[model samples]
Target: MGDYLKKACCLLFALTTLAAASPVFAADVLHIQPKQHDCGLVDEGVPATMTAVVENVSGRDVHVSSVKTN
Candidate 1:
């Protein structure tokens, strides 16, 4: 069906544009050391602190607004 094909093309284009506009697509511009870390044998209710190195290799100025921990 011609109408169905036209709709499918439009949907694909919209999805592609959405992906390109997302910040997740630009994540590769930064290099983060120690992508994963292990804090071993931590007691409950105690705080643990770790440091991560972030480098910008994208040849463009990048501002890091925040950092999150899990």
Candidate 2:
């Protein structure tokens, strides 16, 4: 029974590791360029704008529900 329990634990660990390392779990469905941008300086009441390109690399039509920015 002890050996069976040890084997079960090892099998569970191996499955968990394999699932975590799978590309399907790690691959990003959307690719974003220039993840971050720095605007040197801005005056009060002034607006600064930055542009980023987002592409879908998953080879499937993806509907963007919403977008948010900080």
Candidate 3:
């Protein structure tokens, strides 16, 4: 029925969103190498926090998004 289809779609969306938002796995570190600099300039260190997206697709938990460094 139409109502059933609607409910199914809503459930699917909710599940997908939840999976996308959830942090099922985490990395030990999110570091970005700083560019080399001269004696006068300063170099910034690696990032402390970063954002990542995890997805549960095909019933398998996987990291689907690109790794980002802050």
Higher-TM-score candidate of 1 and 3: 1
Task: Provide the TM-score for each candidate, comma-separated.
Answer: 0.41, 0.37, 0.34
For candidate 1, list the clashing residue pairs, or say none: none
Candidate 2 regions exceeding 4 Å error are 23-54, 57-70
Instruction: Pick the winner on TM-score between candidates 1 and 2.
Output: 1
Better of 1 and 2 by lDDT: 1
lDDT of 3: 0.54
- lDDT of candidate 3 over 1-70, digit per residue (tens): 9999999999999999888766543432232343443334344884344333333334434443654434
The segments of candidate 1 whose C-alpha lies over 4 angstroms from its true place after superposition are 1-21, 28-43
Q: Give Cα-based local distance difference scores for all models.
A: 0.74, 0.71, 0.54
Name the best candidate (by TM-score): 1
lDDT of each residue in 1-70, candidate 1, tens digit only: 9999999999999999898888676676665445556556677798876665555556777788888867
- lDDT (C-alpha) at residue 2 in model 3: 100
